[model samples]
Target: MHITFEKLLYREDYQIKLDHIVMNEENGNRLALYFRGHTDEVMVLIGDYSCNYFELSFEADCVLLRSSDLHELDDGVEFNTIPLVLYKDSALLTFATAWMGLKRDTSRDWTHYAIRAFEQDFHVLSPRPPVFTDLGHKMSDFTVRHSFNLPTES
Candidate 1:
């Protein structure tokens, strides 16, 4: 599969939203998802990332779906649509997180992220990052609250 990206403006709970469009060669199918997270999100997402100079992470909430039925599938395809955190790399690691079941995680925390956003910061484990040579904006200027929770292994 292949992916494309776009960085969005700052928001309340996130610093940036990484937009993605994914395509597969054999089936010619496409999946779209984005993750919005904060500085702590950046830390967790890139804790093990060793690809490049820097990367971004975010506690993300996603909606996953095929491109063909975007409308009828109005169930909300939102995986490729959240704020990202930057680390040693700035590229979205699509393949790495696919097996993590982030989007499919219907846990209460993931399900109630939207409503919870108004009362407090939205938090998650899978933060996202997008690759770029330059974003044409200074990263220091936009600083939101940094909130993250590293899961404890059972």
Candidate 2:
């Protein structure tokens, strides 16, 4: 099943708990996150991300998609709209930190991600939506296949 940004952004009742984070720069700077909430576990994969931009912080409360304000094409880009674009003046200013940059290319599809966690606040801008997959097994068991050790959240 394809999960769009719109679907992920509007869940007011669901407190998405981040289970695991995997960052592999050797594999095209791929970043994968396992989150459990609202029903089952799923993985958000950002593959071939070497060309993309990302930042990580030690602390975060929540995630917010950022947008820019200097461009006219962003007139329709809102906090919960499609064709995600992030600006510094958008509604997410209070939720979490944002990723700032020049006007995005309207010709290409982009996914603005602001993932907040105890050990890391991931801010990423990709040319496409991340691959979302439903986990068939427990997230703990799935993460064992790959060697990853993220600091446990206190």
Candidate 3:
């Protein structure tokens, strides 16, 4: 699976093209699904992420999925999709809080609370550094291990 950003404009609009979408069953059958979209609403891609980023932290770990990983999957199979925000390390705290908010049903207060939390924790954790030259190789290895069991559509 490949997700290509054809173009992103300043009007908060963009187009994404997906290719090589294939789903393979255990028996070797394969299926393909593909489409393109442009939207002003970020929620279409972000899901519950429409709310402030700070409020995103309380959500459970399962709520987040890495954007890069999604692009590596065989395309045609239907799987759960979530906001790509989880790919940003800076958003980890927000996601953790969102996880909690889901349980307490107090997500309404998440935005304000998350802002305060960010201020408090920002100094504690150093900013993330850029990946090393071999990052791609390491990521490929990790993806193979993690997604090996996922059904392929080829």
Best by TM-score: 2
lDDT of 1 at 122: 29
For every model shown, what is its TM-score relative to the native structure? 0.18, 0.38, 0.16
Report the CA-based lDDT of candidate 3 relative to the real structure.
0.25
Better of 2 and 3 by lDDT: 2
**Compared to the true structure, candidate 3 yields what TM-score?**
0.16
User: What is the lDDT of every predicted structure here?
Assistant: 0.30, 0.39, 0.25
lDDT of 2 by residue, 1-154 (tens): 2333454555443224455566645655566666543422122221211111122222122232223322333334333321223344432332222344323344644344554332334445454456555453342333334547976899
Worst 10 residues of 3 by lDDT: 114-123
lDDT score for residue 29 of model 1: 37
Candidate 2 lowest-lDDT run of ten: 46-55
